[model samples]
Target: MADYHSPTVIQPTIPSADMTALERLILGHIFDTEADGDGLYLFAEIGPSDSFELPVRDLRRAIAASADTESTVNAYISERIAALTDDDTHVEIDLSGMSWEFILQDIVRRSPTLDHVTAISAFTCTRMRPDGFGGMAVVITADAIRGKSTNDIVEDFLGDDAHDALYAGTHVLLRVREHAVKEQIAEAIGADPDLTSINPDAVTESDIRSACLDVVACSDLSEEQGAAEFRAAVAAIRAAERRDQAPG
Candidate 1:
């Protein structure tokens, strides 16, 4: 189990062919790039099917014309990754229970032959206060942050050779966690509900209530308001069942 962080960026080596199609798709999206000026080029690649190649002269021109080139590029990558989706996708990786070092080490271990890896960076888990629903957020940065401002650093790394690959991989990892949480919640309730599943590793106070509601709705044991009383009753029954099975 890894300590849950808000977001952490990792640079995974190219994985073997054993990875799922979705994983391959993400990896393909990442490592796409083209040579540009002075040994600089657009570094992001989404998949084998998606990529961008910019000439050095063109890159310089674009940066010169924009007041915030790095900001622009970072925003582009963020938007692009957010838009990615697959039909009936359901998988998630939860970092809340895993340590950062272990997670990174696992990634590296999983792809021992990959050589393009450069750097992996991440932000510590930060508490975010939403108007009504507050939770912790993990921030991940895969490329080097070189500029003075965060925006500049983003841009510089977005321009790295591995930017796209890093973005796609990180995005996939996030989705994996989301799906895993949903799955756990569904299993807990013995019924699939409309709300997304709660990542057990990062379960919030709200998640507990949400799960309780689902359990009440699905259990065969009650029919009233399905309030705390019902929950306690059902929980007690479950506890007794477990206790009965203990290896005595």
Candidate 2:
């Protein structure tokens, strides 16, 4: 077999210095698979194979190597699309519509894939690195390549399906923040008797702190005044933190 990484006098091969330049050639096809507005790219990347094993990590590395020609790269992408969606049961891939949410999910779920980021536009993936913390760390520098999740135009263009997975994470976060705020406010009131007298949590301790939650926002809907109390308590607690942090 001829070596593409090194050329003999008769057959010219890509030099090590220009390896990055070689990576740029297939970048268009990579991004195009995503931009085509179908889920083929993600499904192919993370979906299970015949034995239900995911080989996307290795598959991507092989395709991204300097030794791969453009035609072979295109064939690989095509084969992946077919392999992932061959069965009628896998129809969901086609319905997904090029979602960034799906892409991030695949990145987060897969174990072995490594992400290589570049000052080169995020849409253009370069050489594959052998190491990373995991998939999430791989894309830490890849915010620019974001699809419908971060791109306003793509989100709008893709409509409701695009926001589905993105907002699912957001919903979980809102719940966590609400729980944290309520707990913080309750701790403050319990610790301070003087503050307990305030039925409204929104009341200012000395005049600082933003409203966090009302009692009405919690399980005690009957305690209308509890809302004010909760807010005021939260404010007082934060105000205390600010005072401590202030310079003498």
Candidate 3:
């Protein structure tokens, strides 16, 4: 073997507060893995003197450097994505149910292996309703070439049989808001309080009167008043639907 010499490079000292613990850890990992004999040098001289320096040898360093500033973080993550292994994986912490477009856009902007992404999936609890509290979790795994479209990849993963297994036994709860009288009538008639698919055509005035009388008997409402109210409610609903169907 001939003589081997690593390149000589100057490492800049960065302030501690500017970088997060996770960012520093990622940088150190990348530096140890990818840096040549001469450690990477951070380019921070153009900004204010108080700005921190970050020399990245690998993805970790790049991530740390970007975490120091908001605008540069995207660039840093993009570079790191390029430097990451073909098998790089990512996890998204989403407790706010952000739109898929936003999530994927951010991921693509920061990831080098965007095309190689093989699988993406969500993991979350039923309590974290995507429609309500906007809580969700996402993870992505990629192949070596990073050659797939994010939308297609995410759709396929979601469509997979394995993905469905995760949501097994999870009951979705839907809230229905109605007048207290309507709810009582539904309960008395053995109809679901939340059911909105009742066909008015399939029912008659007699049905409404009967339901109302039952509700009144079961509750505090006077039977005569309840029957009158039920008739009025049915007429109102029918009128509204007719108005909706009529041309504006």
TM-score of each: 0.17, 0.20, 0.16
lDDT (10s digit) by residue, model 2, range 58-170? 33444556334333233434454455532333211221224323333323232133232211122212334332112211222112233222255445668777678668644
Q: Locate the minimum summed-lDDT window of 10 residues in model 2.
A: 3-12
Question: Local distance difference test, per candidate?
Answer: 0.38, 0.36, 0.40
Indicate the TM-score of model 1.
0.17
Error of 2 at 212 (Å): 13
Model 3: per-residue Cα lDDT over 26-120, one tens digit each: 33432222333333232211111212233334435545555654432344345435654555554222212222223223433444434211222
Which candidate number would show the highest lDDT if scored against the true structure?
3
lDDT of 1 by residue, 1-248 (tens): 22323222234433443232223223333334233332212123211123433333333333344423233232333343444354423323222332333222333334435323333223332344332221222222232122143445556787885777667633221112445556665576555455555444455434655666676576663343356567777999999999999998
Q: Candidate 1: global Cα-lDDT?
A: 0.38
Q: Rank the candidates by lDDT, best first.
A: 3, 1, 2
For residue 26, give model 2's deviation from the true position in Å: 9.2
Cα RMSD for candidates in order: 21.1, 20.3, 22.8
Q: What are the clash counts of all predictions, listed in order? A: 36, 11, 14
